[model samples]
Target chain A: MAALVIAEHNNQTLNEQTAKTVTAAALVSTPVHVLVAGENCKAVAEAAAKIAGVEKVLLADNALYARMLAENMETLILSVAEKYDAILAPASTSGKNYLPRVAAKLDVPQISEILKVVSADTFERPIYAGNAIQTVQSPAGKKIITVRTTGFKAAAEGGSAVIENLAATADAGLSKFDSEALSKSERPELTSAKIVISGGRGLGSAENFKLIDKIADRLHAAVGASRAAVDAGYVPNDYQVGQTGKIVAPNLYLAVGISGAIQHLAGMKDSKVIAAINKDEESPIFQVADFGLAADLFQALPELDQELAKRGY
Target chain B: MGSDNSMKVLVPVKRVVDFNVKVRVKSDQSGIDLANVKMSMNPFDEIAVEEAVRLKEKGKVKEIVAISIGPAQAAETIRTALAMGADRGILVKTDGEVEPLVVAKILKAICEAEKPDLVFTGKQAIDDDSNQTGQMLAALLGWGQGTFAHSLELTDASAKVAREIDGGLQTVELKLPAVVTTDLRLNEPRYASLPNIMKAKKKPLEEKTPADYGVDATPRLKVLKVSEPPKRGPGIKVKSVSELLDKLKEAGAI
Candidate 1:
């Protein structure tokens, strides 16, 4: 049986992570099948079919699936589970939310946020806030896994796959989604951005966050916050970067006024290049930093901006 | 259904240093040791215990049994849960770090004996941040699971769990005999009162060994060394905010 990957996309467009998920799926099984669940998501499904290594695109279109609610999704995915040996999803919020339920229903262990696929049944993942690496073998009949998209390259585009419609299952009337207030920003998302500039509690107040924002805007980078910043009310909870928060692996990560806590490092330690700017040389962030600048961020922000502008970025 | 047929609820708790503790990397670069570290109940696990207690309070749950897999010191964590209204406690004594898979295997054996209707665990342990044991145990038992849950409700035969997802939230409904992992926003756990703490001392706490479950508590990953992270250079404070701005420009931080 082929590996089945759940596509992360709205009806209109597919997410980049879906392709990375396909890449991860290819490691375990042959002829990957991508499942796209959304309302009127034919365009998205068609796009998904073009990803290399995918043999089929299973489309389940229904109003109940418009929001990808776990109730309806679990039913739809479980209906098709018998035909696949493994079910994979990117370790995003959506995957983390529903994959475990699927694992439960299948009576299999769900490997969450795997960093490496050692084999079809064995995997390596970070434990204890990335302090320890664990390699585990699933003792169940089927393998259920969530892949961290950053660990693999997105599959190249342009391959034809069969797109078949799958019937939606009966809706499980569970919790009602009250509403969502998504942050609107022109900057790239923190997870997908190539460059990220984050601020820590040292920024003092929410008002001082603009300093980090200016630098981020100048570099066309996403703005992130440490848990300290979020706890201090300097930013929303979504901006928090740590073990309990968002994990990002970007090309360049710059930390300003942040004392890098171990929890915070667990989220971004995989970044390609790290830069730290803080008044305290004793801050832990400097240890991992490729470039360390010991200066008050208040004085460093304008200098960074001026330099970037001079370089025509 | 008769009261005798009610399902058991098993909750596992852990002791961690306070999240607010300003941890400093030791100069030797070895791993952070908690010998003198101020410890508290793992925040997410506290939420798990709270949810279990609430279910019992509402009469939806019959009995709440709390367990902790750690050194004898972990008894303190179990006592905290008992004070929160758990019916009994189990301490699986071990020293040092226990591999998540080994822990999961042992828990699965315990759950098999208890035959719980539901299981609750923190989404991840704060100290190691490994979010594996709950899912692994669910798999080992062939039960359903809902992870990173922020809200949950019970029905006649299934559970409705609200889980925190990236960019939004997703809700899953699963049949009973499920595992649910708690996140921070699940609830603000209540503090144990004096009487409750005293009462917890008398609550049943059974001690067991990992060997009882036929699982080896050996670690798969070995630490070659533990060292403090590197240090930052001295800070150069600018004379004024404008001067600071100028320095930022020079450093390209802006």
Candidate 2:
């Protein structure tokens, strides 16, 4: 049986995580089909059809699915659930919101944030804030899973798959959309950036967080914050990177003034190059960091920014 | 908003390994070592209890019932909720590892019997972090779900919840009798006072089992192994910022 992967996207652009999820879906079963459910999202559907491993694209364009609300998305997924044996989605905020509803309605257990596709029925996931890796086997039936995008390589765009139009499911009328205050930043998004620089409570006041910001801007990287830094109001909740916050696996992750708690390390330990600058030499972050610099961030940040400038960065 | 309105709320809490304690994997790769670890109410569930209590304080709610689906010790977690101002408690006692789907099924049965106007649960427990129960419960009940809510405003007919999304906040309005999952920044949970803790002991706590609800709490997923994650290699400490930059350059990280 084929696997169905729900595509993650805004109405305009396809999120790269959808491509990564397609990779995981293919590993679960062959002939993966991508489902794009949104309003006026034909371009996103077209993009999903080009993903290498996808065999088909299921497009359900309607006003009810514009925001991909849980009630509406669950109804839509279940309408076509009979054709697939495995259902998969990226563990994004939207995916987390709706996938379980489909899983419960289908009477199956949903695995959240799997890191590896061990087999058709077995998978690996992190628990206890990524302190442990657990391998689990799903029962024989429909498999429901949310893929952690950082754990898999993205399926390259080359193949041309057929697009099939799916009818919209009836709206549950259980919820209504009001408004959104999305953070508008000129910098790259934290989860998708190749380079990320994060600050912690050791940065002191919110004003001092500018030091981390300047370095991030110079490096053309996204800005992140530890849970303490966010809870201390040094940054907004969106900037937080931890177990409860965003999980990022960038190429280079430089944590400044951040004493890595296990929860904080859970979000970024998968980065290719891990570095830290903390005054405390015995911080737990150093255990996972490939490069550790024990220096006061206030003095070191400015010097580092200047040195980068000297190098024409 | 009237005084006679039956605005009852239900909050579900879980007992988890304390957040401050570092969790260690067992030597046999069976699971986490829980032999001597201190356990506390899951932090996000504490936030849910606090939110429900705040609603009751504002006269928007009349009664609060806290529930847990775990061992008898989970009643201690419910006691913490009662001390935080919940009116009663229910313990769905099970000694095994009950996954989110089974917990949702059990909660669905309780909702049918209790008929709460609102159901609040933590977004995810820190132990398993499956993040599926609330949404699954909502599905079984055919109710709206506001997941990851940081701010919530309730009315007679609906609730306006500002959720913490990936990039920022998104507000949605869900009809009454809906399920809402609490996230961080919803509100700061208050410490239980000595008097309140003493008062909570007398609160009604009814114990039941998954069998009582006619829900099979059997394990659907089999655990193959539980092992420690791969450890990074030991790193050298750089004495100066210049050396740090040089090392990063050599590592092709700059």
Candidate 3:
């Protein structure tokens, strides 16, 4: 019995999180199999099969899996629970939705957002939004966990695993999908972007957010916002980056005018190079930033963009 | 579950370190120091309580019940919920700590007995930040759930909620006996007036233990250690954008 990593995808392409989850699963066992559960998702299954260290790929194409209703996903996972020693998923929104249902149906406690794999049974996860780390050991009948994809490297694309179709399961009829309103954007997804440029309350008004966008456009970076900026209506709620918002670990994170609150710091502190440009030198963001510039973002955005443009960015 | 005042809402709250206080790791790194530290209701749970109270004020809800599972002092958190207009409180007393899985199990047991039409809780407790109880509870009961809800509209038999997801807002509809967890923008909690505080003192608070509900409060995971996060090195004060760009290039982060 090997570990099963549930792949997160949109039926067309595989999400990067699935590879990171595979990296974690490979740590637990050698024969890692990925489950792609969606409607007309053979492309995603093929993508999962090519990931390094994946020995097998299980494909479950059914209309019940459309939009991934938790009940339907749970039913599908439980049908094959007896074959795997461990069940894991990337701690994405969809993963959080269905993994708990799988764990509940299995009567086993789930380990959420593990940061380190100490052993087959022991793992480490951040509690209180990375304020403290708690190492835990779960010796249940089966291991059910969610890997924090940011903590692990992604598996490479070289393996030639076999893709097998799985039998469908019955629907529980417990829940139904209504409709969803997603933000349509041409910019890269925030979680997987390499460079993230964020603005804060110091930007002043919603119109002032254009300054953050200008730098992002020049650098081809994704734009994010501090909680204060979103709370002040400088941007939409989806732009927020904090403990309660999206956590991004990028190669370069540029903070403009954001006096980094502890909650805000928790989200982007994992970046490789953190750069901050704020008028206040005492901003906590400066403490974590790799490069600190004491200046007004209103004046600095254009200056930085000009510098980047001159460099043929 | 209905649009009228006969609907009953069950709201669960937790006692956590107050949001204003900075938590410090113990010298030995055993855990965070709670001695002499300020503890209050989780802010997100306060939003949950406020949302429930607003429904009551609009004549959409008839009763609101609050519950807390922790040491005896957790009654204070439930008292705050009562002061916010919850009709009653339940204190599930325990000497040791309980994880989210057991908390959900105990809550499910209580829900079975109370038979409330709806359940509301914070998306995650600021202390653990696990964000599991609501989803786990809904799973245990085999019910629908809408988590991280921003705006909620109630129909005659179902609820449509605009949830704050990863990249944008997602609207979901769930049938009766559903679980909903509150996010930051759901609603602002009101100040507990002096009269309500006094009234909360006389509110009926039932006391029970996990054993009473056939739930074992034993921990499943053994905590090997607790340590403070690694601190980043002191940043270089770059004089100009060129210096910043050069540093980023040297670090291979550009």
Candidate 4:
């Protein structure tokens, strides 16, 4: 049986993370099956079928899956689990919410956020805030895993796969859909962006995040925040990047006024290039940064923006 | 609502070095030895315990039970929870670091026996920084889960939990018998009062082992070595802010 890669997408658009998940799946097994579960998600299933190395695309479309409720998702996935050797999902919020349940129901160990598949059963993952790497061996059985998209490339297009429509299961009546307040952003998502410009408490206020915004806009980068900035109410909890928050690995990570704590470093230490701009030379962020600038961000922002513009970002 | 159906809440706590203790990770990276490390209840788990106690105080819950799977020393975390207003405590005694899935399985067995109306845990333990246990427990118990919850409210038979998502907050309404893993922002945990501390000493703390639940706490992951991250190269102090800007340009850091 092939590995099943769960596709993360709404009916209208597909999240690129789904492709990266496919890339992770390819490392473990060949002929991956992409599962797209949602109401009227045929387009997503169709698109997933085109991803390279995808052997089949499975679709489970029903009103019960409209919100991707955990209860219903677990039941639906478990019903089809018998056919797959491994089940994988991108470690997005949605995937994190449901994959563990699937792993538990199957009574199997789940390798979360696997950076590499050393063998069929052995895997490598980050522990101790990415300060240590743990090599784990899963119980030799059907595997359940969540792939961190940042560690793998997105699967390219140009494959033809069979699309199979699967049936949805009865709702478990364990949860109800409440309203959601998703922040709409014209900028790229922090996880997918090549460049990320984040601010810290030094940004001063929530209103001052706009200063980092100007620089991010010029570079077309995503905006992020330190836990201090989030705790100080400079940004919402969603913008936080730390041990307890989002993990992002981008090509270039620029930390502005952010004194890098170990917890914060755990989140973005994997970035290809790290740059810290802080007035304090002793700030811990400089320890991990490839480049450090000792300057007041208040004065540094406009100049950096002008320079980036001159370079034609 | 006054009947046994009134929710029974379970909160799990862990004792770790206080966040303020400037952790100087050992030079060899043989793993952070807490032999002299000052420890306290993990900050996020404190919020979970506080949320549970508040729900009980609000009459939204019938009882709050605090549980910790750690060395006998971890009873301190349970006592702290009791001092904060938990009804009782359970200590799943284990020595050394246990793999997360093993801990989840043990917790799952306990949950099966106790059948809590709700389960709470810190999003991740500060030491291991593995955010897998609670989600694993929820999965094992076949229960709904909400991670990184900053705010939660319980209605008659459902819970309204606001989980911090990627770009914003997602308010999930889960029926009773759900799992919630807390973050640091959940609430300001109350310090234990002297009187409450005295009373907490009297609360029941049942001790059990993973063997009692027919669960194995064996580790699947082996730490080959723990080492400090590579030392960053020496930094050059730019002559001035202008020189700094020029340096940043040269380094392509701008």
Q: Which stretches of candidate 3 lie over 4 Å from their true place?
A: B1-3
> Model 4, which residues run further than 4 Å from truth?
B1-6, B17-32, B220-254
Candidate maximizing DockQ: 2
Question: For the second chain of model 3, what is the TM-score against the true structure's chain B?
Answer: 0.96
TM-score to native of every candidate shown? 0.77, 0.98, 0.98, 0.92
Models ranked on DockQ: 2, 3, 4, 1
Candidate with top lDDT is 2
- What is the CAPRI rating of model 2's predicted complex? high
**DockQ metric for all predictions:** 0.18, 0.88, 0.73, 0.49
Candidate 2 per-residue lDDT over residues A1-313, each given as its tens digit = 8999999999889999999999999988889999999999999999999999899999999999998899999999999999999999999999999999999999999999999999889999999889899999999999999999999999999979999999998889999999999989899989899999999999998999899889988889999999999999999999999999999999899999999988899999999999999999999999888889998998999999999999888
Q: What's the lDDT for all of these models?
A: 0.79, 0.93, 0.88, 0.82
Instruction: In candidate 2, list every pair of residues with a backbone clash.
Output: none
Decide which is better by DockQ, 1 or 2. Answer: 2
Error of 4 at A47 (Å): 2.3
DockQ of 2: 0.88
Q: What C-alpha root-mean-square deviation, in Å, does candidate 2 show against the real structure?
A: 1.2
Cα lDDT tens digits, model 4, B120-218, are 888877776666788788777767788889789777767788887765877888876888999788899999999999999999999999999998887
Ranking by TM-score: 2, 3, 4, 1
